[model samples]
Structures are given as structure tokens and as C-alpha cells.
Target: MNTDRFKENFLSFMNGCEFIYSEFKNGDFGDLQRVEVESFNKMGAVEFWSSGWVGIDLVDCVSGTQEISVLLSPEQRDLVDGELRRFADLMARR
Candidate 1:
């Protein structure tokens, strides 16, 4: 995979989601590391790693907001839930 392209696309996706993201040096995936995305609504946060294709969810303690982190494999990444097909299409286009 082209790491640079993937990073660009992933960042675009995050931007489209209205989430602010940054690459942090130390994380579960080691150096070359994790992407930290915070929800614009301040409801939750997520940390994603490409190495193991993992995602972690963190929700606001007081708000009790529901947070979900889905870890998709390369193939699974292309699959879209019916309701999100349109949004998925937009993401794929990027």
C-alpha cells in the first residue's frame, strides 16, 4: 500500500467527518503510529492504527455518549452499510 496516499485519504475522510485528527508518535501500533480523531461534537474520540487494523473508542464519562470503533480489514473497508452507502461512496471517491 502507498503509505503517503493512505495517510492523505484517511486524513480527508476524517476531515469530511468533521473530526480533528493528528498523528501521534507513541501508541499501540508503535512508532509511525496512531491517528487520534476527536469528535467535533465533543461526544467521543477514537484512535486508529493500520498495523493491526484496530480502533479504540472513548466516550465522555458524564455524557455517557455511545462510541463505536470498527476495525475493518482491507476487503471489509469496501463494504458499506445500506444507510451509509451514500456517505461511503463519497469517502471512496476521495
Candidate 2:
């Protein structure tokens, strides 16, 4: 689970699912997502969102609350899931 990698790959993670934009006139990116993960019996999550601007977050599965959203494409779900799994695994190891 690499926070830096997630930060670096965030935009690219959404690339495979860009076609979802067709669902809405303003759907220029993947739809917002709030995906939670299980780490050491605790809950973790990754989120992406934007109102006036775009943003993403990989909530540490240690002591963070649910406050994230990501633009998810059908194709990008796997990518996001992998990232979250890695993140969760890393946190669980601590």
C-alpha cells in the first residue's frame, strides 16, 4: 500500500473509466466513489471528489474516519480495489 503511488496514479486510475462521462453531460470523469476496506478488523477507505476542483484521498486504515470519494469507472474499479487492498494490508501489518 503506497500512499505516494496512489497519489501519483490517482488521475491515471480514472483514465480507463473515462467513458462513463457519456452518462451525463458533465460527466467528464469517473463517478464519485467512497470505497471502504477491511484492515485488521477495522474499516478503511479511499475517496475522490471535486466541487470547484478535483481531489482524492487514501484514508489510512488505522485511525481515520470515512471521508473520501473517487471518480470510479467500471474499468477502474479493479485498479482502485487493488490500491485499497494494498493500503489496507500495509496498515494491518502495523
Candidate 3:
């Protein structure tokens, strides 16, 4: 991955998306923190939870299917995934 490009895109996405944060207790993991961000156009969302995990999905508002991988390149996905994990780790410190 191109670190510079990834960082640039990740920052741009985070700045643009609608961000929400919440924390809850899990039986196995104690406290879990979650951060969710939806694309400006509402076509994609990324969910990041504590403990080194992340999820990315492209939404189809009409069909309600999540098979819209064409909206993002593999490199873009990887960049988002890595940044989310990093964000989760940062949240853990708070």
C-alpha cells in the first residue's frame, strides 16, 4: 500500500463521514467501543469495534444488498481497514 495515499484518503474520508461513537459492556470482553462512519452519499459504511476488528460494507439503498464492491478498489478497502484498526486502538487509550 502507498502509505501517503492511504493516509490522505483515510483522513479525507473520516473528515467527511458522519461519525458516531458508543460503548457497551460485553460478557466476554468487558467494555467494547464502537465507531461507525457512513459515507456522505450514504452508500457505504464502516464499523470499527474495540479489540482489533473492522467491517466495511457498501449499501444499495434500493436493492438492500451489500455486494457493491465495485464502488471501492481493493487498495482503498485495505487502507480503510488499517485506518479503522488504528482508530480503534486510539480509542482504547481514552
Candidate 4:
């Protein structure tokens, strides 16, 4: 949950994946933000967005957006969930 550890883990997760670059309105801040992610396994041209706390798969390449409620594999989900929980705990302590 420390910044250093989070960066290390995030980099490890993202390494070797081909990330497509894009950005959009986040609705909170009046500014656009960049999104980088490995291409969608099924769609081939979509990227995922972070839901503030954790990254959730989202497709915004086409006309309508694709809401990925559950996209990651079981093992990947487990890893992400664990990391998110750790991050929350860390924030609470601060």
C-alpha cells in the first residue's frame, strides 16, 4: 500500500502488455485524463479505466462505451482485489 510498493506491483502487472493510449472526461474534474491499458482480449481495440480505487475494464473506442463489470480472469481479479484492499487499509491508517 505504500507508494513505492504500489508502483512496483503496478509496473509488474503492466509489463509486457501492449497498451493502447486514450483519454476521456472523468466527470469529477473538468479535465480529460489519459487511460493506458492492454488491448481488449475480445474487442482488440479497447482500453481499461481506473475507477478511482482500482482499474476496471472499459471500452470507449467505438460509439457506445462498453461497461466491463467483470473482465479480468479469476487469478487476475484475486490479485487486483488483494492490492486494492491493501491500499484501502493503508489510506485508512493515514
Best candidate (score: lDDT): 3
How does residue 10 of candidate 4 score in lDDT?
50
Candidate 4 residue spans exceeding 4 A from truth: 1-8, 25-32, 39-55, 58-94
lDDT of 3 by residue, 17-92 (tens): 5556566666332344444545433445343333333445555455565533332244355565554445433322
Sorted on lDDT, best first, the list reads: 3, 1, 2, 4
Residue pair clashes in candidate 4: none
lDDT of 4: 0.39
**TM-score of structure candidate 3:** 0.40
Task: Assess candidate 3 and give its lDDT.
Answer: 0.44
How well does candidate 3 score on lDDT at residue 23?
60
lDDT per residue for candidate 4 within 1-94, as digits (tens), equals 2233444555454434454445565644232233344433322222233443334444434444553434333346445556444423322221
Instruction: Give the runs in model 2 whose Cα sits over 4 Å from its true position.
Output: 1-45, 48-75
Q: What lDDT score goes with residue 49 in model 1?
A: 50
Return the TM-score for each candidate structure: 0.36, 0.28, 0.40, 0.30
What is the C-alpha lDDT profile of model 2 across 1-94, one tens digit per residue? 1234444644343322211111122334434333344444344445443222232344544566533444454445456555454544443443
Instruction: Please name the candidate that would achieve the greatest TM-score relative to the true structure.
Output: 3
Count of clashing residue pairs in every prediction: 0, 4, 0, 0
